[model samples]
Target chain A: MMRAVILAAPSVDALDNPALSALLGLIVITLIMTLGVMFATWYERKAVARMQQRLGPMRVGPWGLLQPIADTLKLVSKEGVRPASADRIAWDLSLAAIFVPAFLVLVAIPFTADWFVSPMDLSLLYILAVGGLSFIGFLLAGWGSDNKYALLGGMRAAAQLISYEIPMILSMLAVVMVVGSADVYRIILYQDVVPLIVWQPLAFIIFLTATIAELERQPFDIPTGESEVAGGVFIEYSGIRWSLFQLTGYVNMYAYSLLGAFVFLGGWEWPFGTDIGWGYQLLLTMVKMALFIVFFLWVRTSFPRLRVDQLMSYAWKVLLPFALAQIFLNGLVLVYDLPDVVLLATSGGGALALCWLVYSVVRVKPRQPLRMVGNVPATAPGSVSG
Target chain B: MPFEALLENYLAVFLATIVGTILVATALIGTRILAPYSKDRAKVTSYECGMVPIGRTRAQIHVRYYLFAILFLIFDVEAIFLFPWAVNVAQASHSAFWAMVLFIGILAAGLGYAWRKGVLQWNR
Candidate 1:
């Protein structure tokens, strides 16, 4: 009954008729994702432009609404080529490989209370597992291109992702521990009284950082670091092939924002304590997602990229410990039936303390350079290489 | 019926994924066919900062990254163990919570070993 359609009878019918619902949901979500990509591209440009005190995309259409279309057309018209030595199959498949997982996660996302495409009970797990597979596409892209830079990018991306995944899941586990279900809708329901962000700001921040790393966004985008590795995994791609990667990135950006909104900002639930219509419910969810998108854009424009090693350490030493603290503290709070303030104080204070401890420990050492075991010449008189 | 309903949900997800993939592929193919394609040896050759490409592209990878991968597999499996416990948190006993505590502690110990071994250090 919770799945009843909002605003009008049309959506309700779509929701009730299981077969028809799938078809309609596909169409709707596809349109939404495409439009989101278009809009996000423009939004990112404009936001970055304003940050630098300049106008962006003013000529094409009203507020440059047509910019993305022009960009897409340009991409399609450009020639996509493969290197002679490239793995043709993997090179060709990489675009779709990157694309498919993002869209699948989209299908699992709850757009609104009644407008969900597929409200799987295990939505969190499904989204995490499926979305996490995009790194494979990056790996394939790197390996397929037969370029050293691409391989480096791909490998760095793999490392970044592997390191970040631990903290990301650990942070999400805190929420799961509290809610007791991986179902996104159920998590939302548990937030009826209060959103998890208010309850666990530490986890929220950890997740935010982890997600940035996961998406390979600015400050964590070593995989596609343009200046260093020449577009990293995407070094060999051109034309529509390249655009597909861009599309996947933008769409997943929106998807992650949607996930963040659902998990932490209370999904379609109105924070203002108002019972709105279904159409408004959909709109509210969108608005929340849009806010998160802006936050992502703002952070992207503001921060510089972390060095590969620093990035890994940040995950393993800093965010990982905080995430673990979130779980341990939550367990204590649950078993002891401690007051809610205890949860807030311990998580917040614990995060600060852990940050300082990690920074102090890591900073003092100021990491040394790496050399292979055989590379070091033995200076000792008894050594073989002396 | 509900189980079928559940399956129907996943069916839609798979379908959506297919549709999205097809849409992208169609665009790529359309571009591939329509775009001007006049290639030379230079155009198709591998790129490396505009030089005659050196040796092999596939370099031997450092064991550091592989170490992270090995650790990821271990932790990811351990993380999966939480779902069952989390799915029924309402009736979780003191013992149930403590089990999680012990597990996390063991994981932390492993992490400590990694840290002490300089596995967590990036530049070194």
Candidate 2:
């Protein structure tokens, strides 16, 4: 079935040609990303449940296998609500605006060496540009609701996303400079002898950190921190609209994982060998992506959210400089023809510098509690007590 | 496939975006039709934990976000220039490498200036 579609897709007429294949690919990927979310939700619940010593969703199907499906049905059947003061057009437009960009991200992602939608020359740039657009929907949703908290949430999310994007791009820039291509496949191919992770551990760490922030995962998820400003930009959405946001979040998580795997983890090629067939490479890439996803989940459930102010400072103060320095180091290596050992040493030195930089920037004097115990009137009715 | 066939691949992306949007719209509109919507005055108003809402959303947004937009534009354009240069690196001379170094040095200096000015502090 798949073979026929791939081979026959080009023979069709111009309008029908790409559209047919696109339609088929979209449906397949949509289903895959949807299923990825479902499995991830179950995996998260089961993992966290076990870690916390509790059974999670045991009654729904065998071992809670059907829970995501059940949740989807419930969401589909639930009434969709709109805020009274909401801007109707933006409220509706926000759903597509957020999700379409996320879906477009899949366009540039390499599922396998052979299987991918668009292997464009600027695929890397394409992904980043489209990924950046997702937050705008949140901004619109926040504003459209005419809710104060929503606006705050939206702005906070905007600031976090925009700040983090610099480090993320800069980290990718390091790899792009070393490999000498912005093409995803070309980058992956450059890792045949040794993965980029082994080549540039510091960039790997920076990229992962920035990616977590980009996805708004825990330790960086203050935008939707329930303890503070309610659900933030997504507060007003309900029913299917809310589900789209949820779906976008999960899809983005998987997409970034795939990107990390491709760029740093040797992509489809295994670390041990480069002669592996497409099948093995595909499996290897998926395994790497899965490992990344699991790591993200662990970090997410384990960490507490950072203050919004701290998040901004971390991006600008720590990550941005580290990224810039890494770029300089990588450029120097390229110009001077440095050996792998030197690059490795540079990675080590870069890591130490990053740690020191963060420590210095985040250090602060401990706060003392208010000296005055319970509220006593400054001037007691008739006489003032000093 | 020919190299020219490469450009056609993006058509798939454009189509996929439309399909994905339709899929979301299907779920949203599906629920909108299948599920009952209650549009009572109180139900439709913004959520505030059973209390009345105060103030407007417009006045609350600070100018820092606008700064973020400008900063993002600068960096995005920088990345855009880096892409083509990175792609053509193999064909370029040692001079090409120095030229890029100059470009990125200026970019970093600009970011450093912004940091020194405390333009990146979000909450302040």
Q: lDDT of all predictions, in order shown? A: 0.82, 0.80
Query: Model 2, A319: alpha-carbon shift in Å?
Result: 0.9
Per-model TM values vs. the true structure: 0.89, 0.89
Compute the lDDT of residue A239 as modeled in candidate 2.
Answer: 81
- Highest lDDT against the true fold, candidate: 1
Q: What are the fnat scores of the candidates, in the order listed?
A: 0.74, 0.71
Q: What TM-scores result for chain A when each predicted structure is judged separately against the true chain A?
A: 0.87, 0.88
**What digit string (tens of lDDT, one per residue) describes model 1 on residues B4-122?**
87676588876877787788778877996888888788898887867769898899999888889988898899889876876665478988888777887898899999999988876
* Clash pairs (backbone) in predicted model 2: A84-B44
Interface RMSD of 1: 1.5
What candidate 1 gets wrong by more than 4 Å, as runs, is A1-17, A354-386, B1-6
Question: lDDT score, residue A188, model 2?
Answer: 84
- Residues A96-160, model 1: lDDT tens digits: 88899988888788776766777787889988888888888888989999999999999998889
Can you give the lDDT of residue A47 in candidate 1? Answer: 91
